[model samples]
Target: MDKITRIIAYAKTKLQEDLTGHGFDHAQRVATLAHQIAKKEKAQVDEITLLASAYLHDTIDDKVVPDVAEALAQLQMFLAEIEISAKQQAEIIFIITHMSFSKELEEKVTLSTAGKIVQDADRLEALGAMGILRTAYFGGSHQHPLYDPAIKPVVFTDKTEYRKGSTVINHFYEKLFLLPKKMNTKTAYEEALRRQKFMETFLTEFYQEWEPEKANFF
Candidate 1:
């Protein structure tokens, strides 16, 4: 209804069509999580901006944005059209660029509350049944295995190992499981618990499926 809200709706619809850990379904789920946490956090953060940030967080994701530099410039220009100020635009870009687990060790950047909210929202999607589905989808897309019993997730001694790390499942152990501890709000923390249990259950089932004795149980 409002100007920013309209920008958000249009941006989301477009990203949903072009982006994916699978598709728009994933974006909607993340957006819902953002709204849920936003409602529960009761922080002084702007709901419109926070929700907008969440919905568009992955607009320029490594997987989504084909030409990273060009996409980013286009993204900044797009935000300009929506009447967000330069500082507010910086806040949104800072959150998306710095909040990623993949790049967290590469660079340490400060976050705004809006950025934190979006970070929490996006990470939450990587933790539940939804998380499992997205991981398998992305892993399959990237030619990574569904699970690799031979290769255990390595504990990083440094960022290099973390960057060139193991399969996508390794990402769950290395990062998603650790996210709840990093949550900036009570709302995000509580949601993390439910999703964490979900990921745990998923790993158990996935491993079980690979074992001869448990293979047919499903």
Candidate 2:
């Protein structure tokens, strides 16, 4: 198989059974979004590198693998076998490693045009209707509470604090609501605004349903 086809097959195999929202479907969606954004931006980005990074972004994530170092080593070997250029491999790895929201929250990292497009696409997945479903799926898989009035959202200063979230509803305030402003590309930024508005509507309806008695007050 060609390298791109092989990478897609590998990603599908790796994420086929994932229940925490980082499944193959999510990867595919991100890859598609990245490609669309790249074309729309008409920037001097490497489409192959961006798409490859999108497909493999979560493969070696600590959230998915018990040993990130080992997973990444294996990924490097796979890239070498596929005969991807060293520079392209580096670009893909750089985008995957730095694209995560938690990583971005922790430190500022500059990205190439390709990296920026991929990052925007990945972050876009964390908004809108799909974002809500993914959040619910992840929360359910992890046994996190759906909602709790007393468990207010906390401003996370680090990845640890972010992951220690007690309720899924708090995620809106903590991250989802903030993603629109963080988008890297103009096209994605506009799309994010629309999705962000949808999330707001969903949250409003959710609160009303959660407490019909307090709906008038809201």
Candidate 3:
């Protein structure tokens, strides 16, 4: 019945059909992470805006929705219809639109503390065991190879370059491994580093499996 409840319902409906790991469950996890990060860091943030943005962040994402412009318009209309105030709507829209990694590739947009919290939460989701599975799932869905030593990881500086896609293993180097330094909050940063280390361990085993002869010799 409340505005945040309606926003969650809208996000769930929009993201439920996604198969690329950006589903409603992923959004819910991000919301939970945002809440935890804010509390751990003792940062004063607008909870309503943070939670709403976390839930809806991917609803209008180009990766999730076919027509991003249309989705954005529909989401704005829904917010207004649900009686959310203008200032809150603006904050929510700004956070969701600018918090994405692809968007950051284009330009480093300044965000509010709440936006930073949500951004950190989402980035954290892309770093650990969950991140590895999500990367593999997305690559499988997009027809990207699991690993191709022939095709090396790229240093992408733009959305076009980033979205062109790369091998699943290469994604760890290209994006996921670099997230720890980009974290905004100390809590998120520490956790990101821990997750990054776990991913490194995972990759070590993957390489050992991929090159069994090398492992056998050792």
1-218: candidate 1 lDDT, tens digit per residue: 67556756756665766523735566667667777777677757766567666666677776776777776787788788877778778777777778777677677676787777777878788777877777767766667765676888766656666645578777788777888887877888888898899789877876776685867774
- Candidate 2 lDDT, tens digit per residue, 86-155? 9999989988988788897788799888888888998899999999999999998889999999998888
In terms of TM-score, the best-performing candidate is 3
Model 1: residue 191 alpha-carbon error in angstroms: 1.6
Error of 1 at 164 (Å): 5.3
Tens-digit lDDT string for candidate 3 (1-218): 88888889999899998999999999999999999999998999888888999999999999888999999999999989998889999999999999988898887989999999999999999989999999999999889999988999989998987997989999999999988999999999999999999999999999999999989956
Runs in model 2 deviating more than 4 A are 216-218
Ranking by lDDT: 3, 2, 1
Each model's lDDT comes to 0.73, 0.89, 0.93
State the RMSD for candidate 1.
2.8
Single out the weakest 10-residue window by summed lDDT for candidate 2: 42-51
Off by over 4 Å in 3: none
Give TM-scores for every candidate, taking all chains together and pairing residue i with residue i.
Answer: 0.85, 0.96, 0.97
Q: What TM-score should be assigned to candidate 3?
A: 0.97
Please give the RMSD of candidate 2 to the true structure: 1.8
